[model samples]
Target: MTETTDYFDALATALLKGGMAEPAVSATLADLRGYLTETGTAAHEEFGPAGEFAARLAGGAPAGEPVAEAETWKWTADIYVDRKHLNAYGDQGWEVERIDRLGRFVSRRDPEAAMCWEYRREVTGIKDRTAMTEALAPEGWEVCGQWLYFQYFKRPKAASAGPAAVIETPPEAPGRRLFLSGGYRKQLVATLVAVVLCAALTAYAVGRGANVTAILIGAAVAAPIGGLLGWYAVKRDVLTGAKES
Candidate 1:
């Protein structure tokens, strides 16, 4: 048999021995075979030794009977602090399911069977998204969610640290949800001030019997302009912060 076949045989046998069901083992092999073909690299080169790779894969994916319910949590943080929180919660075995419409992270963990997870965020345009995913695929990162021009990827912590990735006991779920950074807080305050000022002006105009049509038209025009300015300001702040560090 060729080296590829030989490598897969060993991997499949290891996965089976590690308590992964047959169907899951087969799917994992198919995916890995496709990856090796696309990258034109040997399985051992791409994934290290077959035994170790199996340990990593099966460590995160231990098979067992389904539970009645799994613990769930949902929370969100600003771009500046999101990564920090993701890593922190992931260490405790929470797996993010998706980013909700409000950009909150919806996550869950099975008390019966749970493994440590890790996450990273990348910023890229739609055009570069394919390349970004392809580059990270070789390392076992899967796209978890995308929002606000940022892409989040996650992987089992076991993929890197082998058996060490096992979490014996997870901590209590965090209570506080919103984790806005100082920058976001400042922007919120500024936005509230602008809103108050606009409301005051509208009230004064109504008291003076100003044209309602004219006031409505003025607001319609200003809304987009204010939004554009806010977008520019946030981008500038991000860029400036990047350069400073």
Candidate 2:
């Protein structure tokens, strides 16, 4: 038998063993065949072993009770703390839906039935992100969100761990609304100081009947002064992290 046929035969038996009805099994195999043909890739390569893939599909659709309405939360963190917080919350069964307009993570968890999620952040340019997404999909990751050059991906832990994915004694919810690194805080302070300085200079110039061009020059000079300080703060933090790692 061909590799494709061998894979399907194994997948069909596994799906049936996993409680999929016969009709559904046949339809799934037919769809998979078409997908493999179109992509010019073997079934096992794209979806992994037949037994494991069937288990993932079965796990997502358990037979019995209705699920409770999901509880939702929105929160955000600076780049320094985002991954740490994301994985923490994901372990507690929070699945991030998207990053909203204000750059907050919108997440949900069904109290009655929730799956542990795993997340990772990737830094890449726009053009490479598509390739990155394609590469990750075969491993069951789906894009969670993107902000500037950062990309986030998530997958249920069940995809790899099967029944072991359920969390016991989940961690407490994070109390603080925002997570900013010391470096980010320094940057904010620097930027604020610059803004205040500029405003004071502009006001003082107007009071003394200074020319408009002079005020513009003061503003421009003060703005970059704050920007430079902020840049220095971030650069120092990045360097420190690199050294420690």
Candidate 3:
């Protein structure tokens, strides 16, 4: 039928399949309804009523099955020093400990056995920074700015006899940061020059017997309007550059 109806139906289907906590799902839907009404989107405004109806149906439906165990896990690798051995190595030589699958640390001495206070482990497959941070907090882990040094684990090869090799995948490269293009810079400079010229013209006109106060006020007003035009020119140039790139 309508777009709003379609959206409502899709949300209902997702909730049914996902088995999300009912109260949270209901609250999220209500918030979405309010957002739609505020934004005055025709589809969302009309969809609100349909969503309410679907929400009622969902409330009575059986909860879906519990989520399956994660197929993958991620671990944070942090460097720590053994304070007990500090006197021998000046500052206790640094050691790299691997945060295990359960968010616990495992000593390199015993990779297969769980070591107390040596590592951290938690559920894995986190792609966002917030979730990753939360997972690592129980262990003395903190994000070092934007970079995260972590490891991921997957299902073990049940039949393999050899030790599991930790696979290291390179982090995704960031997009190139953009600066204002030369064309936009030129346009901005031109606009500033035009504004200055316009002010000088208005001053000269006032000096030549036009209403001085009115000329000055008019120049002040025209400067912003001229600048706005210049801003648009710069924006257009930027868009053209983006398209070319």
Candidate 4:
């Protein structure tokens, strides 16, 4: 299998086995899929073609071209999470704490941006934490403690005089709502159809009467199994729709 396909399959399997709540797992998987798609598209554009790049590198050609490609790869692979929203909450006297994937905390306080700190004693990156902190101090941010936290504070926005605008919330489509709400009904209909089809197939096998015991057993086992699978599909779809909504 291709590297991308293998990575995706592994991620899917991990998602399936992970003990996270269903909604969280589904959202996480969706995010990962979107990231992978974007990454793949960027890689393809930069590398021209994966197969061509691999062949050229394998033949021990000049390393200059591949070195340039490596730099491009690194640029695209680096992912940064923006912390601007933390400042918004800070302005409201709400202390915000955000831990990145590496467990580095970013926090902020109210009304004192200069007192804010970005702790980096235990964190990687930023060779000179003190200098970094000093530079950010002007912007009401700082670093402090061993836990690598970035903190800041800001004033809240003033309230406006007129009436607040009415936000229009979109209504759910009728057909979509019906599909989501009729899970049990759909399952029942599918089960009945399976039973009828199994009965017909079993009758045909009996009419032949030519050592059809195995066929009968197979149909008996398959009928309920198929019906259960169909029910599961419908139920899962409905659950996913509800979660998304």
Candidate 5:
């Protein structure tokens, strides 16, 4: 019963967050509550995941219309895969409202297929971040959000004078992905080095003429390096294939 109530409450919150009117959201929740009461069914059994359900509702509506302050809006749950991914959607006329540890939500009134957006991401401190933003301002990427160590920036599609030049992703996307994924590669190398060092130490220690001094020295160096790498890998959640950094 508690889980069911929590699920519906979360769904209601997401709908409201997506730009549905309070009365509309309230009415939807009320309808669900009544249905559940009459049928005695679990919320998940009926509605599925709240994020996906909200996405379906958001998608069903028309988009790409110019919005007024009081105009009804719609939002969908978005995956956070660095700023490049979000920029691709911006190219399609959507804009990110906010993104945090929980999830990302982007809003659009009337989405246009021909439009494009560009984005850039960086990891830096306040001083460097300010500098980076200032530099990017001329190119048109506006700072959007910062999640953990990463900062996101975006800009609307650039206008083209030539007969509607085809819009495409920025040429730097591949390079950026390689750069971001490089951290994990370094950790992987460190992990492998640790394993090989331990193996070599084990072999030397068990040899016919084992040297205690060599074994001790190897252990001292290997233990710290291996321990540090292991701890970092776990902290980065590399095993689960989460964000690389």
Candidate 6:
């Protein structure tokens, strides 16, 4: 068989294996054939390897799900840890599943990079924690994850009413004020402070001829306390911002 014929045959085999109906596969192939004939484009040049194309086409349907080309869906984990971004994805039918430790939002949809709001509050004192969560729950917000002292939540995308709803400003959360502001800058500052304190104590001990053993012990304790505080603060802020959407 010619390469073109071989390519289609492979694609046909793959489609069948991928659970596509025979009639639908035949129709798809017929349309592709006509496109190739009219454009005078080599199948490989226009469509790349047939196996790859077939696999990609099959991806839209997923296992046990029959999906139309117009309703073809894909997964995206490109969401940031924010409600606005999650909501934007929600608007388009994407759902936020979880946020990783590093604050990346994993969402599943039939689509692309999306923007939505995220709101977070640290599960600080019992009073703030209960009030914040109980308050947000009524406003279509759902908890996604809780890391350290942080509580993550997202607002689902608004339903479309004809023309896509202009993305709305994220709702305000009462406890949002508790979150530390600044992005990575806040974390960097905390880390820097820890390092500086450690270095300064070490330098002071050396210059003053202080007991090296005692100095090292002090440094070890001080550094970690500083570092942990910093780390906790950042984690708290991250979750707070993520939910604040």
Flag the better candidate by TM-score, 1 or 3.
Answer: 1
Model 2, span 1-245: residue lDDT tens: 38888989988887777676688679667756765655466788767887777765454333332233345677898877778889888988888866655677867676656779999887768789889999999989988876666789999999788888886654555666677776567667767786787788788888899898878986788678767777666656544442111
lDDT of each: 0.77, 0.73, 0.40, 0.37, 0.55, 0.56
lDDT of 1 by residue, 169-200 (tens): 76777888888888788878988888788888
Q: Which sections of candidate 4 miss by over 4 Å?
A: 1-183, 243-245
Runs of candidate 1 exceeding 4 Å displacement: 1-64, 205-216, 236-245
TM-score of 5: 0.38
The lowest-lDDT stretch of 10 consecutive residues in candidate 6 is 170-179
What order do you get sorting by lDDT, best first? Answer: 1, 2, 6, 5, 3, 4
State the displacement of the C-alpha of residue 2, model 5, in Å, after optimal TM-score superposition: 24
Q: What TM-score does candidate 4 get on C-alpha atoms?
A: 0.24
The TM-score values for the models, in the order shown, are: 0.64, 0.60, 0.26, 0.24, 0.38, 0.42
Better of 1 and 3 by lDDT: 1
For model 1, what is the C-alpha lDDT against the true structure? Answer: 0.77
C-alpha displacement of 91 in model 4, angstroms? 36
Q: All predictions: root-mean-square deviation over Cα? A: 10.1, 11.2, 19.1, 21.7, 12.7, 15.6
What is the per-residue lDDT of model 5 for residues 7-79, given as tens digits with 9 covering 90 to 100?
Answer: 8777776666666667867855775576566546587875688766654444433233222222122232212
Query: Candidate 2 — which residues are off by over 4 angstroms?
Result: 1-66, 159-162, 168-176, 201-212, 221-245
User: Which candidate, 4 or 5, has the higher TM-score?
Assistant: 5
Best by lDDT: 1
Model 3 bad stretches (over 4 Å)? 1-180, 235-245
| Top TM-score model | 1
